[model samples]
Target: MSFTVYNFTNNDDVKILHQMGQFQVLQWDRDLSLAPWTAQQAWFASQMDVRRRQLIANLDGRTGVTLQAGAMQWTAGQIQATTGVKGAGDLLGKMVRGAVSQDSMIKPEYTGVGMLVCEPTWQHLLLVDVAQWGGSIVLNDGLFLACDSTLQHALERRSNLSSAVAGNEGLFNLRLNGQGTLVLESPCPQTEVLYIDLQNDEVKIDGNYALAWTAGLQFSVERSGKSLIGSAMGGEGLVNVYRGTGRIMMAPMQAATSYNTLASQPTS
Candidate 1:
């Protein structure tokens, strides 16, 4: 019930918004604002610095806090908006990609484990800064996590976390390298996340929404080879496979799940 919100004082400084999902009073504005410039009190001012009334203002109103530019919100998997906030510079109608950039200084990139966020639709909030490379989060749904955390050295059970792969699925992984901020969850964010560079060639993915593929591609399971009384006597059968050249981010409606939903997300 809280995707975004930050109201400080009656005005002056803090105020971030985002909740129009199902809509009600509807709120907007994510253009950031600031204070301290000798405190005068101006409320609606976007990227326009003609030195406003210059006492000491530079580009971006000399930087204090002010947001409302454009081009932020992008949908490929799940995005449910319905904006309409008539307040400070209004129109927060889009831009849902918030989670970092209060100035971004995030650090810490090890002690990780297999990742996990396979369901709850994996939600969406990205502000990447993997902190100098070290990869492994392969999940187009089917998350695997084993890294990234801070301040909680408190005691035991810490074998690094994320380890689920015993039967069937095989290599289940989540092995990040350091520096972090990964909140991935895409049943199908408009598909297209490929990486097919093979030497064995043979790809097939009707569902599983691959997040990273290309190890030469070679997985099996294209069943229904005619048996079962000749295709259950006939529904035409013939469909149960995934050959491999290693690259699959399919879901034009693979049907694993998709109707484009929203209820604050997170149900898995």
Candidate 2:
């Protein structure tokens, strides 16, 4: 019937970084540590970039939110959960998609007047509006965090066999359709992201840096240049190429390097 989160506000260390409609993204200012690690924590905090854990989808009952299975940290007030599966057919479809995509089979949905908190991590949290993304957004294997109940989820495969084999990404990616706000846990900070909007054009990347792209685009693995010799001379073998008119969000840095930098920026 009532809920009050003490010492969590913009005035405090824990601030509301962003809010879209009913969804609120709360960011902690500093990393918390135990007494034994105080000295180490202080040294690291001062020397390295602080990677704060983010909370997603603080609900207040105007609408409902669906979360990746087991993502919920805590919930308060009048909120209830559902399996988000319509029937036996939907369950079967989810199971099949889960098998290929490696996503949750039965994501839980929560509704009514309450605050839904998600497990915090060092990963960056991005709140995307599906309508602005042309009503469909396909994400790399493991980014889906949470979304409004209005959105729909499906599994989409790469455009060709070469993409599946050479791109070094999974055969099936998670696709979110319909209209609503979707929460994403990006590996890299959004400040470092490069968004490419193509109009009947093409863009290529050497690695799996492209996090999410519009479903309308065609993604395949192709040589860097026209001929085999040219590709070899270019020093780039096969690259993931996205063609057609659509939008893509790419993190320019290599995945492992960026993650290490975020997770543990070593002292210089």
Candidate 3:
């Protein structure tokens, strides 16, 4: 019942970017100590604009947190983990959803009054309020990190088949519904993200730069120009289009780049 974390919050090297409800996103301002050779690598990483960030999940005994499988790094106090499975049928359903959505099949849930920390990564951690998205939101692939267990999860399919095949996005997306906080692993920093609010309007993008959007929005893929000749002349082909009224979170930069790939490489 009694616990303390020393040199965690007090450490000058760590910067707290966001904290809400039961989650906190922190970033290490710099790696202070390193060998000469590794220090050179760190300097190059700095020049390349890389970041070291982590997510902290704080359970309050009454509420539990659901995380992507294999995301937990460490935990303290009276914490317990469960598969969040109800029955054989539920497991099968989750498996199907996971297959189409490209998300972890069985998300692990943690309960009890404790602090759970996720593995550190260079990817930016974003804390989103589901309520801000009108109690529901659909996320692009691979963005889901963690969420309050109170939220409901479902698969949201594309508006049309062409949208799935031509847009470069898959057929189904993971949708979360309810009033809770959701954590996302973003390829771009929050500062670089563009937030768009639409009112019976539409927006088009040449690539999959959208991170998340309101679940009610109608999404599809379409030509950038009215005709094939125009599209070819404009040098633009299919584009992702969102219609209706909702909010969108878009990153101006491409999601796949050297910065995101660096996480897969071993680090000293």
| Overall lDDT per candidate, in order of appearance | 0.27, 0.78, 0.87
Off by over 4 Å in 3: 47-49, 256-259
Prediction RMSDs, each to the true structure:
20.7, 3.4, 1.9
Top model number, lDDT: 3
- Candidate 3 overall lDDT versus native: 0.87
TM-score of each: 0.23, 0.87, 0.93
Lowest lDDT 10-residue stretch of candidate 1: 49-58
Order of candidate numbers by lDDT, starting with the best: 3, 2, 1
lDDT of 1 by residue, 14-83 (tens): 2222111110111122223345562342233222210111000011111111111221222222222222
- Candidate 2 vs 3: which has more TM-score: 3
Q: Can you give the lDDT of residue 21 in candidate 3?
A: 90
* Residue 239 of model 3, lDDT score: 85
Clashing pairs in 2: none
Give the winner by lDDT: 2 or 3: 3
